[model samples]
Target: MGTSYWRGELWLGPDYGLVQGQLGHTTAHAHYAHQLIIAVGSPVTVELDGVRHSGHCLLIPALQRHAMVQAPDPAFSLYAEPLRIAASDLQRCVEGVEASLPKLQAALEQCPRQPIADPRVERALQALDATLEGKVAATQLAAEAHVSLSQLERLFSRDVGLSVRRLVLWRRLRLAMALVLQGQSMTQAAHGAGFADSAHCSRTLKALFGVSAGQALKTLNPRLLA
Candidate 1:
């Protein structure tokens, strides 16, 4: 990957939570999940699929290749959880939300309630969350959820917006960012977050977000963005 060439802040939200970015400049990249932007500093513009959308809020479905450009001003993104989307009435409430810190915080908090309508899918998600520290086979996950492997796949694809493996990688990458924020060196972050090496983490981050680990590492600020 090339130099990041952008200036902004990116931080891991709470564990097993959102990856939030205070967006400025952008390069093209495909993320692993559904993305939602609530424009704060400027009207958010997204180039998704073939068309461009500019709105106070824009929702990009998972695995859809897109780029966000706002230049001098910044917007905020919540890599929205599918279970949250399923449970919350974000569409109805986000439009009415004032683009400010306090209001946005309250609105976001109300959006995702757990133990969602489908117990099986919710159980699968909880199982996956519990297994993030170690590898869990797909079949094993299915059995733990009391569902077939194929059912697990469909549930993830349909609800969470990404495959199970991709979500696991996403979690690992977020954990890496969190470790870095806690002042771990890149090598330590990689090892603790389950990457083979710092280089492996860098490559994975670049592929997933078009930003280098070194460049993004500068953006971590625990007091402000965490």
Candidate 2:
């Protein structure tokens, strides 16, 4: 069988994003965004920390490593903002993904964690998101968040499921993915996304997402950005 996947729809924003598609063989990798996926027709399976999870619907939290293969069938998956996805929202959001794209978007946008949210961490994350190039100092970010460096680190780990260092690189890779779609060379995309070089970008992508940047582009197509 030919091993290319066609994306159905892609919705991306600073806070949350979702993409759905048919899938082929995929390497194991972990990402910063919490993920939810459902099979459109046949069942999908994901390998988690140890056991294999196979089902019609499931959600995987941020930073928890997993690898997925779509069983040569139709599939869809949603990546939610880790901090925004509440325990209560998982079922509803997964349902929303299957129901309608708009509903999925709306479900993703609901601010359930608004009151309990910390603005410092939010600002820090925003800073990380905008960091398309170069390293931003943790001290500078801590100052921006009005917290001590230690406090900021703790908050990031608690809320984002990653340290500030990891999140920064995660944002860079994400930016690189977009730049790749715009026809930038992998080397160009790497430099633009703040990596040392294309080799560094390739290694990071393979380590974190279990595929090279080129392989990812071949595996899935982005049908929509917003």
Candidate 3:
């Protein structure tokens, strides 16, 4: 069967469950209580420990702290119990999570901590860091690197823990935040970030950060903005 764009759910433990049925931006606030495992069909950018990732899958440790910003395309997410898998087993578990949701549920029976090396996906990271305020496409990046789009996807999955499109979205979000910090109006930020309008920017910011642009800016420490 073909993947359905509008069909997706969130598998929290037996106690918690969520079903998403919309085509808009989504965001989870910084949570320190539960680890989260997210699966996406489109590209998605995740910010954790001050780093941004885009690619296939993401594993966020509980109490470690992070934020998720969805890409423009529709996506799906699953949140499992932190104790279900150890740190060392994260990679394998993430790789297998979607294939057998039931097995993943069973594996969560034992929460083991496995330590894995960072994927160290740097080329795309460098490109994003350099062009946060500019317009760039995954195809362009792949071409520049002399790799096909699929190869870039594999590299992003293996090294960055996300996808190329997600990285772009994340970069746009970051740029939006920076513009807001600079005292730009919502309209200005939206236009600067290549969004259609202020409302579009507001929707995305709210979905990813769980706050409107005004609210987010108010919470920023003045020193950090400066």
* Segments of candidate 1 deviating more than 4 angstroms: 1-12, 15-22, 38-44, 86-88, 112-114, 223-226
Order of candidate numbers by TM-score, starting with the best:
2, 1, 3
Winner on lDDT (2 vs 3): 2
Clash number by candidate, in order: 0, 0, 18
- Give all candidates' CA lDDT scores: 0.65, 0.70, 0.52
**What is the C-alpha lDDT profile of model 1 across 60-130, one tens digit per residue?**
76577877655235556655544555323545545577655456556656675544567777787777767
* lDDT score at residue 6, model 1, on the 0-100 scale: 38
- Return the candidate ranking by lDDT, descending: 2, 1, 3
Please give the lDDT score for candidate 3: 0.52
Q: Which ten residues in a row have the lowest lDDT in candidate 1?
A: 1-10
Native RMSD of candidate 1 (Å): 4.0
In Å, residue 9's CA in model 1 sits off its true spot by: 5.1
Pairs clashing in candidate 1?
none
Superposed by TM-score, candidate 2 places the C-alpha of residue 182 at a distance from the truth, in angstroms, of: 4.0
TM-score pick, better of 2 and 3: 2
lDDT of 3 by residue, 1-226 (tens): 1221223332334311222322233244542123433444565676677677776556665445455554444444434323233444644544544534455554544445433342234555566556655677777677666678898888877754456876566557656656665678768887788766888777766655455665545433321111
Error at 82, model 1, angstroms: 2.1
Better of 1 and 3 by lDDT: 1
lDDT of 2 by residue, 1-226 (tens): 3253444555566556666666555567788777777676767788888668888777787777787754566666677555656544655644544356666667666635433278898887776666659877888889878899999999977777788888788788878777776678888988999999999999888888676666666545554355
